[model samples]
Target: MRRRFWLLLPLLSLAGALQAQAPLDLPQQAASAQPAEAADYQVLDFDWQDKSRQREVPVRLYWPAQAASAAVPLVVFSHGLGGSRQGYSYLGRYWASQGYASLHVQHVGSDRRIWTGNVFSLIGRLQDAAKESEALDRVRDMRFALDRLLAAEQGAHIDRQRIVAAGHSYGATTSLLLAGARPPDAPAGLQDERIRAAIIISAPPFYGQGAPEPILAPVRVPTLHVTATEDVINVPGYHSEAGDRLSVFEATGGQRKRLAVFTGGSHSIFTDRAGTGGVTLNPQVKAATRELTLAFLSSVFEGREEGLQSWHQRWKPLLARWQ
Candidate 1:
């Protein structure tokens, strides 16, 4: 169930919008703050219809401190092929603390449990021979989540100008597709215009026979593609090729498009504090990954140019081989 970016064409999908003032549709838009000036963020779980998985999807959300009554920047996080809402918790917490609204979505059939036992059942869904609909479901899921969130009373509270889509591996592919990166044979309807930025981590070359195109190619928004040269899953497969594809975006007009490679890290290196078995949890990979991811997010989200510099300074020695 850990989906590859190359196999994306077969699984694109959709979400329905909720009406305003519906608490079930929106939940509490903001986080609760303690009286003592403690860390404040709203973490809530909500359900959305996932046509690809044919079930109601649950999402975990985090929001920044109540600094403004208007809409704030938003960061929607997606998990890897076999991941859950909890997979990208690190980004959610970090962004929420920095004044952005973030959400982690759970993909039912493609989650860890399914991958553990019924992976074939999920894979069977993608048996369209051509894999034309590979990521169709995930695309729908992202769109519906956006619709539901924006339709919520608090949805209006989100700063549409700064909406960002981010994820790891398959999730990163989802982020890219939502941001409008199309494989040569991709369906036209799958694009979501609301996404203003993208942060893709360890995405693969799953777009079938399409020539290598940067995930940021069609996106008019800023984008950050983060990968690890040591990534056993992607480096030899997708990361190297994607840079060529995404370069097209610069011509299309977006600001600050960048690709950051972590020298000593692996595919799952961008994970939260508690990383998956293959990436963050490993003793040798933990600290370096944590520092790099935190710094990358800080720079990309907070506009702290130093975030990039700090990452290079710390990892340049390890990544010297990449250079």
Candidate 2:
């Protein structure tokens, strides 16, 4: 009973972290209508294997319905811990509508099974050294997925130069690895040169080892960091404060780095179907994130800075803290 009580307490804190939409006294300007809606998009599901890693990664691909003038840009998504490729459909769907391919890849180890075994199992694995090495494994999954996708028949429709790595939470860490964020413990040659840019959603600070700045020094690619002021992920043995996300944004050395810190959102906002409550569902937060991320990708993927400029001009007021 005590153990269960301790576990549920964090979940309650997480629930309580979500605040109601702004009150009448605290008025907020709505964001510019980000082209969040994708045009028509097609979804395909497949299980791909990496013989070197001896793992089969489940992937859900979302691409523009109509053929493009040239190959469409692709963003490979890695979901948060215990989350499947299907987790953040909002990002996948929105990007696809805008004529980009969004591929969500699932890492088998340290995945959904961790949460399903018991309510507390997921939290337990966070500090489990045996399970700690899985982050590197997840990085391998991203590289292998890219190798296979760019070689498949469908590869003909993807713009090889515009591939971006994106993820939230632990998945965000995986994307960072691909973008050149190296943990001292991770093996050499894990970073991929093909990932031209990256979107890091709720990336945690490199805790206890050293300063997050030096740890993230290797990630010099164009990057975007997305998180909420109240964003906190409380696992059993670890502490994830909003500062964790902020540290990554502040420390990154990317020449074109951007941070979108929204007001009153929680860790759950990154997922499509899951909402912690009112704050995660706030229209202002949602609109700004969707539009800002789209604009960032637009700038990096299409080699056009217009969308990003429009974002700065129109959505600046809604963003609580940004650079």
- Write the residue-wise lDDT of candidate 1 on 1-323 in tens digits: 22333564211211011111211111121111111224777778887776655766778888666735656888787777556787656557656666678878776656555445465565454333113354666677777788888887668678777778887767877787787776655668776787867776666554434344444446666666665444444321222333432333333235656665544444554554222323222322334333454565566657787876865665554342321
lDDT of 2 at 98: 75
Highest lDDT: give the candidate number: 2
Candidate lDDT values, in order: 0.57, 0.71
Off by over 4 Å in 2: 1-16, 23-39, 118-130, 277-283, 301-303
The ten-residue window of minimal lDDT in model 1 covers 14-23
lDDT tens per residue, model 2, 1-323? 21121111121123224567643222244322233454588888989998877888889998788635568888999887667877777677778887789999998875566556666654565333124456667888888888888887678889888889998877777788899876665568877998889999877666544677776888988999998877877654545678778888888877889888876677766665333535324555555666678888777766778887877667665456877
| Candidate 1 Cα lDDT to native | 0.57
